[model samples]
Target chain A: MEKKRNMQSKELICTACPIGCRLTVFQDEKSENWFRVEGNSCKRGINYAIAEMTDPRRILTSTVKVTNSHYKRLPVRTREAIPKHLIFSCMNEINRIEVITPVRMGDILIDNIASSGIPLIASRNLE
Target chain B: MLNYELVVIGGGPAGLAAAIEARKNGVQNILVLERDLELGGILQQCIHNGFGLHIFKEELTGPEYAQRFINELLEMDIEYKTDTMVLDISEIKTITAVNKQDGLIQISANAIILAMGCRERTRGAIRIPGTRPAGVFTAGTAQRFINIEGYMVGRRIVILGSGDIGLIMARRLTLEGAKVLAVAELMPYSSGLTRNIVQCLHDYDIPLLLSHTVTDIRGKDRVTGVTISKVDQNLKPIPGSEKEYQCDTLLLSVGLIPENELSLQANIKLDPRTGGPIVNESMETSVEGIFACGNVVHVHDLVDYVTEEAQKAGAGAADYIFEEITEKIPAVPIVPQEGVNYIIPQNIRIDNLNGFLDLMLRVTSVYRNAKICVRADEKTIKEVKRPHLSPGEMERVRLNSNIMKTIRPKTISLYIDGEKTQYAI
Candidate 1:
């Protein structure tokens, strides 16, 4: 079908402003690394478009089981954005761990979780 | 009755910040009473980052933001009682509170700060046309369940409002393996921050349905489906534009109302617009010694603003106690005119003000290339040009002493000037 040969393009909304300008991205025919970004109003949008096309990352936030604490769950997060594909695998390793009571904020619970080299740290104190 | 210099109700961000500031201002014998078992209040359940961007100058999670203040309060040796519910506050600063450990207790204070924060609007408030089901939950309640209790609400969901809580929850649920059908918003535009829309929904490939409302729910015991319809300009559902989606959970992120039950009992004059106590530049309520801030004063979009506003109330209480405020000046009302929804500090005590005062307000609707004007004595005093304005985002204008000195009018009015421009996006 003609649809199968259609060049792949993606639409993204610029996160820089509340205006949220919709952007369209196309891979340049000349080079695989070159991208033609359209519909961005500012430099931040162009940067967002390029990064999204290349390496997209998201901050992972979730809760882990807590033992012998006032609360049953302790909130945890990656110190920085981890590779998007490793989120579920990271959750697998995170679920196996049980944090003890008297944990302070920024306490690294797991070092390089799921081989992403990003530390999963406690976001709150469980005293 | 136990007597103290100051008694702060609610040990959340506002109360804690107020208590700490008051302590630093030489006001001793302060007690912070909190109804929750923990001191941080709702911040404990909000596990998302993006808080403290303005205060700490770095992005921190909700709990991390509260912990920073909690750590500071700990070193100060400030007196606080958790699991203590304040029942009533009398005109004479008599606080009637009860706690399991202390039983029935009455505390008389020289000054009091009300920072009870706010509560989420539930399905009952909006009267969604549906049978009472097990799956209906407020976005905040669901957030507390998932983030605090580590319990997944449902496998499939249809969120009713695009509030920040709802938007954040959409991503949270999606990441946890639940399918979010769509985030239906009654308003045409999102009430949440722009970053939330991009990160929470756009990143997750979740659809945001604007100018849409849930017309019907088709489940008896548990939510099985929801019928959504495009809304008219009046916000009424269009009859023929209904579309149905199959989902198991229904989350409501409608809105929030400032918790002011004690304010009512104390007979503090409330501004009908803010749904909180009427306050002046000093954050002092009509009742001389009573002060209010944070959501107890008006709903704020950012916790950073809450901390800043509460510090004003804290300093106001300290000024009242330390005799720094010699006279209570007659206040000049700041009236909201065209394009302006409402403004905080409903009244301004120009004579009592030192340095500058912040006049925070929101617009009634979206505007572009609009100029916000402040007028007094039938003359324009101060004007600031804004590229765009929306109801979701609050705009703040600073009123310096020099401007106040120029205006001797009994009332200062704020309104929009210039032509309305189209939204670029």
Candidate 2:
């Protein structure tokens, strides 16, 4: 006895780890995106698919500005994720942008960065 | 030609312990070589606490935990060489080294142990297609900046991978007045420890985005922003649900790979599953007189385990030198069963096996509840029920040598029940 395929399909291999997930990607027309997915055991696998197929992004780790603080620079993270293609632009803006003193962790360092609507704040606070 | 009775590669927790144990076991001539100027490996910069609790019975910062061993080895009159990089090690028990002061030196050893730790998987390793920006950093590197260098890396930061390091860094950045925004993890469940999630993210009100990841890194001279989205099970990006975060810095805490170049050059048999040397119950490698432990053997969450393994390597080396390993080596093959990823100590021959034989493992998937069993030739040798199991968390089980001897079967299988998957029958 053989189990028939649910509407013939192809397997999309994911490189989440060495354990590549042979996933079955089926388009669900409701959302109009790569709709239904299976064969991925981890959440990262599915997210890896959507990002790879359409657009991708990364969580940026860098510095922020401080206002007259003892420490000139402070570590920071973005309030939201940036566009996959615009990662360099965001970093370039950060490199050029410097603030003066009084920055704390979670403080808004840059608001509406490149109009992407993601805020960059200090990942760590400085005196 | 430099020579010694025992030559330990790496000065980390594992290497140091092996050196000390070897000395204690009457190995007079011993030497340790470290690539970094500092003897401690990743521990020196890990400033975060919660280390050494298992080994020392009290919580200590990574540096402090390393200090205890560093100070002990220092007092033991052990010989150590820092800033010495081992280029290669020969199967005949010879090691080549180059230092800033000493150009090249070949050292022969009676016994050698590979204790080199692991390295973090970088963005390049993950192959995130895009422009190479200035603001990208591994989470550990970023940690060194805020804690040691005392410099700001970026104003806006987006963390990829909700591992313990990333989660802790998210909270650290948030505390330092930076906007963490959220932690995006591709996996539905966080790969970090439960405590880290609760303390670092949940307590700080930082959101943990499960089933999400950063699809791209934007910016040229630096980072400008990034695009992220939820993924389907097939792990393909979905359109229309895409969202963007305008941030400068991208931090990756993807994963760690065991550093094992010396082992490879030594022609040591490597466990592909662990990317480390495969050792027997005595922690001896394929090479008669060589041994390996710690992250070099297999990455461990607790330093206590590293010390424990180092002691085994040390003791095994001592036994080999004293010609005590004489009994018939009851070899057992480790078979990774359903829903199980890999198991350390691929083989075991427990003659003087004492206490509990701790076997480290990784699960294939997330299981709400599972029971781990060690089966040998249709006989259950050991079993331990776990409340929950995830691939992110490494599992350790204990079995007495006395019990292991009962199933003198050649092959031993570790499998999980109660969680059904395609991989699991």
Candidate 3:
């Protein structure tokens, strides 16, 4: 029997901007880092396709408990995109932490969240 | 009555940007009135990212995007009042508003910018046949509950409509540990951006049922399930195609309507197609010195476009206040021809033409390999070829002022030369 070649293609819609370019990414299993991207109008789509195929990540945005503010929750997001698989774990960790009021935008609510080296920062000011 | 050079209603992104731009252009004594308790408006509840990519050159969450403008307005010392609702507006640029701090105050302004934004279409608007249930909520209301009030609307959800808000809520509820059974869109193609469909549904494995709609709702006190049915070409629910999904909540994101009560009160002429005020190139409404932008003019897909249009209204208001705009030529009416839904700035003043005119429009349906052509009477002055066009995404075309001046036709019209088909299912 002959050995089979491990080659795959995946289609993705770029969410970087509203243009939503359709990207077709071809992956050669022989070389993990090599990816050929097609159907994108801009250069950003190439990077997006490659990043999406390998180590998929997403910016997690959710609300955190707050004290002394009229709002019960203050919105926060990971300073950078974290591993996609860890979103629920990160949310679980985020749910356990609460901050006092007078929080400013860009304030770090959690440094190195979920051991991902991504800080969770406030998205807006809470008074 | 209190007096100001410019008065902007609704302290959302549109009103904030308009007031700030007017101040920057030498307009003094500007006031922004917002009905919400906070200045951020609906953006405060929108915690998701993918905003401000065009204006800020970086992706920011909704609140972050609104906060930037709020900070700028605060830094510029522009006057604004939250929790204030404008009751009426007169044709002469007078505003009647009320708030807890200042009850029933009237203000006169040289220029007024209408930026009340838009409101979601509820279940009542769509008339989904079902029992009145407590679990039914608009997608925006659910967003406010989850992101703002820290409350989970329901454990199981069924979203009715594939608009951006519905798609976003699908992911939001799923991330919050709620099972979003599926999103049903009446149309064959989703009326939301393609990216939203992929990120919000595809990534999370949430099924999107196109050409389907909620025909009935079950449960007396709260929604226990919803009957989804396939619709035919005429958008009528087809018989014997009903499927039931057990869910506790039903979220409707059917469409948005521009809030134009004040516009009507001011005697501003409205375009029936857009359900917004008719204006010229300057963003000035039918009533002189009264401008409208953002969602009040029409529903916008992006906040960046809203900011750009609001800036035009702001600068136009400032120019009117300064008496700098002089009528050089009569305004030319812009007519939407075949394959086009409607065009903003229903008319254009030749003198008001800066360097170029940006015409924003949406096609009636999906088209491929289409040529959007702008004509001046019998001559085609501008044309651009697009590989793909959909009603979900808005399109913009820029016409040079030099070419516009040369033709100076009595009427300007826009039409698309292509075949319209349901190609986006």
Q: DockQ of each candidate's interface versus the true one?
A: 0.47, 0.02, 0.44
Report the lDDT tens digits of candidate 2 across residue range B81-179. Answer: 999999999999999999988899999998898888998999988887667879899999988787656666787888999888898789767655678
- List of clashing residue pairs for candidate 1: none
User: Per-model i-RMS in Å?
Assistant: 5.1, 12.5, 6.4
CA lDDT, every model vs. true structure: 0.87, 0.76, 0.90
How far in Å is the alpha carbon of A50 misplaced in model 3?
2.5
The TM-score of candidate 3 is 0.95
Off by over 4 Å in 3: A1-11, A14-26, A29-46, B327-329
Model 1: per-residue lDDT, tens digit, B1-425?
99999999999999999999999899988999999998888888889888887888888888998998888888899999999999999999999999999999999999999999999998889888966768989999999899887789999999999989999999989878899989999988888887798888877778999999998888888888999999998999999999999999999999999999999999999888888899988799889899999998888988999999999999999999987884557789999999888999898877777898899998887787788899886888889988678788888988887668666678889998756544332
Give each model a TM-score. 0.95, 0.75, 0.95
Give the per-residue lDDT digits (tens) of candidate 3, residues A1-127.
0011344787777765555666778775565558887778888988888888788888889999987898999999999999988888998999899989899999999999999999999999999
* Candidate 1 accuracy as lDDT: 0.87
In terms of TM-score, how similar is model 2 to the real structure? 0.75
Q: lDDT (0-100) at residue B56 of candidate 1?
A: 87
* Model 1: per-residue Cα lDDT over A1-127, one tens digit each: 0011246677777776666667887778675458777788778888887787788777788889987887889999999998777878888887889988899889999999999989999998888
Supply the DockQ value of model 1: 0.47
